[model samples]
Target: MKKNFKLLMLAVFVAAASCSFTTKSFEDPDKDKLLIDLITYVLEKGHYDAKQFDDSFSEAVYKDFINNVDPIKRYFLASDIAEFEQYKTSIDDQLLAKELDFFNLVYSRLDQRIKEAQTYYPEILDKPFDFSVSEEINVDYENLPYASNKKELKDRWRKQLKYTTLSTYYDNIEDNLFKIENEEDYTPKTKAQLEADARETTLNSFNDNYSFVNDLERNDYFAVFLNSVVTQFDPHTNYFAPPDRDRFDLQMSGRLEGIGARLQKQSDYIKVVEVISGGPAWRGEHIEVGDVILKVRQEDETDPTSIVGMRVDDAVKLIKGPKGTQVTLTIKRVDGTIEEETITRDVVEIGETYAKSAIIEKEDRKFGLINLPAFYFTMQDYEERNAAADVKKEILELKQQGMEGLVLDLRNNGGGSLRTAVDIAGLFIKEGPVVQVASNGKRKEVLSDRDSEIVWDGPLVILVNDASASASEILAAAMQDYKRAVIIGSKQTYGKGTVQNLLDLNQWLRNNDMGDMGALKLTTQKYYRVNGGSTQLEGVKSDVVMPGRYAYLDIGEKEYDNPLPYDKITPANYSPYDGYIDYESTIKRSNERMAKSAELKLIEENAKWIKQRQDENVVSLNLEAYTQAIKDREQYAKRFDVLEDYQSGLNFKSLPKELGLIEIDSTLGQNRQRWHKNLRSDIYVEEAVSVLEDLKLNNIRQGSLAKIKD
Candidate 1:
């Protein structure tokens, strides 16, 4: 119902613009009377009570309409500004009456313009839109800092309309919408029906100016705007609208009384993005990712109320409540089965929010795996207690634990603070630039570590997948450029290199009385690696590439609309690590072993099997096929050996009394021997260890280092 307010307001605004309503025209008295009568007719039909049409409300509405509709406000000519001086001051009664007449004249002109616009609106539907006509869509930053003038606002609408209309032709909206359903439930619609529906939906809501202005009224627009503003001040200071604020409050302090799942509005239907790790939904084992939520029923409710087309936060409110309360969700599963599941909510603690460390012992070498879910630090907490210092302490502990090699798993780590990323990268590098920021043609600021102390410098590797973005990409690129760590992951990262400036649209137009125009997230700058490569569309490439499920999908910066173009800048002079480890021969040997091994060969050969599981669109029409698909996928994934297998092999190698002597001596020998012996059993871990050993043996190992006792 709260969401409906925004939609209704937009509909009313659009309807008003489309109607043939005008004010009294001074040039033609008869036309002016006709216009006034028309306005009266609309007012009556719109259910605006004639009795409640007070002077104050009229003034407010009139001012709002003028600001919204007047082309002069968006782009006021010098002469027009001069002409408006007569209306600036309060006048005598006689003069006031004349001024109102002049105002009516201007209002009538705007009314005529709107009527003229309607004629073209229907024509836009009939005409086939050609998107190839590229126009220079650059905004004049100097002239219009904020779109306050009416003409400038119209131009913004023109550009927005052109882009949006062009986009509709390229995007298969029907396919995207229908893709939410499971393949089994998919009743294929004829191409004609799909096209007709798509076109109708698009055309019915095609007014650019109305949408542009209406978005300024919706809470999400302000939520994103305020987030941008707070982010500009610092990444942690966020602005949340009512729904977002409610969600945040629930996540931080509220108890979950319903199913524990984070939902998002994916087009029309609500899709489950994540199931709370230990919540009832996760424990129930019925809900899974990619499942569409159709309805939700409260404990006392008899009928399940449909939740389709509801905002994510609204759906969340319906699903979340006090602990002990039961909530039922009608879920459409990935396999096309719709089922109702009831869950009792409880307190949800975010245990998986931080960086978790694990020791994966492959052969003999123990590799420390640190999975950083997000580069997060509460700014308020940091201000009160030293958070960066604490993270450094943890890294030092991992290093002290006798970790031969390290894997910084940054999968699904949507970036948080820039400050934290730089600080974390500083733990690896001694003292150098980590990332560079170029904004508004100002002197580029190089963020670097001033500290000389280094931690975990032995053999470092960073693992990332498609979801690794922003600050994650920044750190990965810096480490890769400096040759500090070997990056192993998918083809590239989610390339979001541009920086945005949060402009308070309300603040800029305070004098104009534009209530809650919200904030604008204007892309103001871009980040560049110290080596001069831009991380825009082409994200950082891994040193050792690994196959990922989303490898075939168009996953990165190129998939977004109006993504900033990638460009290079002057490279800052920085020292590269001169010391190299001799891991070449060991890597070659490990690669040969992995290539010929039947288990590894089988896993590699079953790429298609993995792909089918990864693909979101691959659906089964029947229960049998779906069961078989799931079975086949599970069987193929199990070909990869577990960590215990490597440990068993290492134990087996030390079975003979003579093998114990070799093991003892190997540990006492150079780090390379210890690494080689440790890597022998765990294929992948051993491969990384061998690479480190080869680097050490090659005499290219940089910096003076000492091996610490575990």
Candidate 2:
């Protein structure tokens, strides 16, 4: 339940929720109203822990919907809020009746307010900001009250614009000073000219943002309102619009038929932020990051269409096509040279998404490290490109290389297939219950490792962090409970113990007249560890709690809004494995070493300082105060520069299997080398290795054979 969220959230693989609802909207007249009825029924019937569609649900939706539309309170005023309050509690009534009067009224007012608000930015940015005034800006918008009138709204916009301009002004000043110092004959611009340039930058940024906002269609806004309604039930539950659902699929698979470049809309220009490593763009070597794509021409067309001011998704639609298709791009390079590059579109597979392995040699002892990015599996084929099979293959290859110890790095692994996690867990252990899953009205189902074979019977260590969630937590919790692997890294993993699955809304309708009604991702179940403890708010506690950047941050499932509470269940009937020597004492020894370690101490201190900096939200508008703030931050940053310098002399190398891949693309080899260098510098990795060495050096086998119990 709690462990399989990511896997379940991957909706591309899941079939239509059920053969279930009302097929056609007869007298509703409006499609939006019909959609509300359809979604409401689905939510009420399908959701595992469905909240009642009453006044309370209505109020929740109202708050979420209003906030989402005008999050910064830049458009709607206090009067608008007062006006909307009439229908706040009545939304449930509206939802029940399939009425759109409240939505229509609010939408119209918001649309008018948006048009009016556009004038404010241009007018406010027309003049230079007086940074000499001893004023402070509080960017914590949630705590602040909305403006009561147009005058107050204008003043609010003015202060925000001033803050944005002030930051840009300071940046320009620094750049100017740097140029004056470095360039022998460089002429520095006057303060007034720099100030004007800063204002222009601010103007461009706001205009670009407003253009994006203005370009949003009614359907897009409808999606926002729909999401607000759905997500109010739970943070995980959401309604993915058609385009969003498609986008989600693209993201999940990480393979798309395109020219293979990520585009960003920057001030009316579509910029190439990243050229996928193995994509057509990287193969051509013609396109690079920071290159602005000006126009796009398809093979069938004679003229290239100017894509300036085009929405990113729209631009992407034009750029992406089936494999073997040729698309010509007119790109403005960072150096200002415009070039026409024609790239043949191909299936761009994101290599980093898959499981990768590296072998580290220290003091003549070889240690294999398998980094599982996600508990991934091919949607079309169960056996193809799955993390479980990939891990098994990697482990077999590593074993052939005379590997002494293994480190399964699960840090930042948000998780994928629940079955894959169980399968992967089975690789190390002989056979036992891996996890216990429970849903509404279902018996506690035990996901067990029935195979009584140990793939890797050597020293094992699992690395995790605050970002390691869902299936990651399952694997960590299982290992920790059985005392099979030494869990190391952050205080605990991300406590997302609940599961979600997609239910296609179209499936609900029988005599369907309405078009494809996307899908609803609802929390269908919750899972518990073998030890009965729920890895919900309280995540899998590491045997060796290492300090990290996220150590002091308000992060993980506990920090998330409206997360399911943590609890415990009946501990699965299984005996703890005592296969290794002094497992308890080994953890004790690791903790003892970590207590006095300077590297871990520095990490904790650095994390605390970062949290402090994050909490300090108020910004000084005065030039001297702003400059001093930067200087202070820079000085503080310098103190932690030594953190990177500390390195363990571990030699890391690519496995024999990836050698061919490295040969084909030297970038692959370079990446491996880079990762190896980082691993050598990684304090957490160093500590894990240290713990593994301790376990390896002083182990007394409790059992003669690594076999499963009956």
Best by TM-score: 2
Residue 574, model 1, lDDT: 82
Q: What tens-digit string does per-residue lDDT give for candidate 2 at 652-684?
A: 888887888789887788888888889989877
Residue-wise C-alpha lDDT for candidate 1, range 1-710, written one tens digit per residue: 00111121123243333222111112443322332333233323321112233443333333333333342232333454355444333212212132334354444454444454455445545544333343533322223344545555455445433434433432344464556575777666654454455455555665533333322222222132123212222222233333443344333222334567777665567899887666777767869999999999998999998988664555777888888888888999999999998888875644456564545555666556666777665433544322245456556665665666666768777776677788888877778998888875456888888777677566777877777888889999998888777776666888878664333434433354322332333455678898988888788886655545456555676774335668888887788654444333433454565556554444344544555444333233232343455577667566654422544242111112224444544322343344345544544443454455444512334324432211
Candidate 2 colliding pairs: 1-526, 1-527, 2-497, 2-498, 2-527, 21-508, 581-700
Instruction: Give candidate 2 regions above 4 Å deviation.
Output: 1-29, 266-271, 284-310, 321-344, 510-514, 663-670, 697-710
Candidate 2 at residue 545, lDDT?
Answer: 88
Task: For model 2, state the Cα shift of residue 477 in Å.
Answer: 0.6
TM-score of each: 0.47, 0.89
**lDDT of every model, 2 decimals:** 0.54, 0.80
- TM-score, candidate 1, is 0.47
